[model samples]
Target: MKLFNFHTHNKSENYGIINIYPEENILFGKKYSCGLHPWHYSENYETALSQIELLAKEEKIIAVGETGFDPKSPVNIDMQSKIFVKHIEISEKYNLPLIIHCVKHYNELVKIKSQLKPENIWILHGFNGKIDIAKKLVEQGLYFSLSENILKDIKKADSLLEIIPTDTIFFETDDKDYNIETIYKFVAEKYSMTLSDLVKYIEINLKIMGI
Candidate 1:
């Protein structure tokens, strides 16, 4: 099965993306998760907004984020929520999963989801929460995009993979050096499934996104 990086931040200016000016040549076969990155929001936030909208329309962009609230970041929570809502709307409008970047604000996220009740798929990338917290999000029908940090606690993490409904789970390398192929191999080994089977399962989820 093929592996996918559902939320990569690497974008190049040659691609006409804003805020980020890639310093080096982008690697082959690397699609990305492009967004405003809340920390960089400033007088220039509008620039990122316009470009992101255009990117959302592009078929090459598989997801609408790495975009969401970050409580620890100095950016206003209210503003963050507003921008996030726009992303959620666009993701729904364009039929893309939201590659989320929540930090210290899961409660607010729960509140926001309750209010908006969005239809788009939301994958909380780079997740490292407890089983109860993970269960809570899954119960709300949210998918967690597991990364290396969470994988370190394999016993607890593997238990999550078991409990989360097969379709409601995904894995990522996040920004780590490890690639999705390696992550898939590990997960495939744990699940006693071939790597290709795992890839096919995720490809189905990607098709689910396209639909």
Candidate 2:
């Protein structure tokens, strides 16, 4: 039963899509997802955006982002949306899934999704938002990758796991240093499923993402 991590920041991990900044060098032979994070947006962002598009052509580059809106970021929402749309274009051109990092911008994200109507899968990574928001994103055809928050509040996680369709769910460590198996164990117990069965369902979800 191999554990699959849909997103992670730990580059040492052998199993998962490792998140990389556009300025970082690609570690050959490892699967990665690259983009210019909203928080990292700068004056020379066009250079970084071009780099991401170029990386998108690589076979090991499996996804387009960890890019999305962050209300707290110095970059304005409009600027963030502009960059996000560029990432969406890269995802579509490469026919790869998009790994999103949204912070208090679900409404904007949903609105963008509605406007763009992208065919590539958009996965919201490190989700710990309200259940209603989760349901709303689910309605918009967005998938989710639950992370360390699940370990912090098992009860809330239980409610979320129950509502999220298994086929649209994935487990990840993100930038956390914990074992991904812990998340899988808790979710399996909640759903009354064996670890292997949980893995099988996640595999099916990955297939939907064209992994």
Could you say which candidate leads in TM-score? 2
Measured against the true structure, the TM-scores of the candidates, in listed sequence, are 0.81, 0.96
Tell me how many clashing residue pairs each candidate has.
2, 0
Candidate 2 per-residue lDDT, tens place, 1-211, comes to: 6899889889987878999987787777778999888889755588998888888875658999899988766788888888889889999998989989999998899999999999999999999999899889989989999986867877788889888888899999888788888999999988899999999999888877778
Error of 2 at 150 (Å): 2.1
Q: Report the lDDT tens digits of candidate 1 across residue range 171-198.
A: 7655555656666677778888888887
TM-score (C-alpha, index-matched) for candidate 2: 0.96
- Cα lDDT of all candidates, in order? 0.68, 0.87
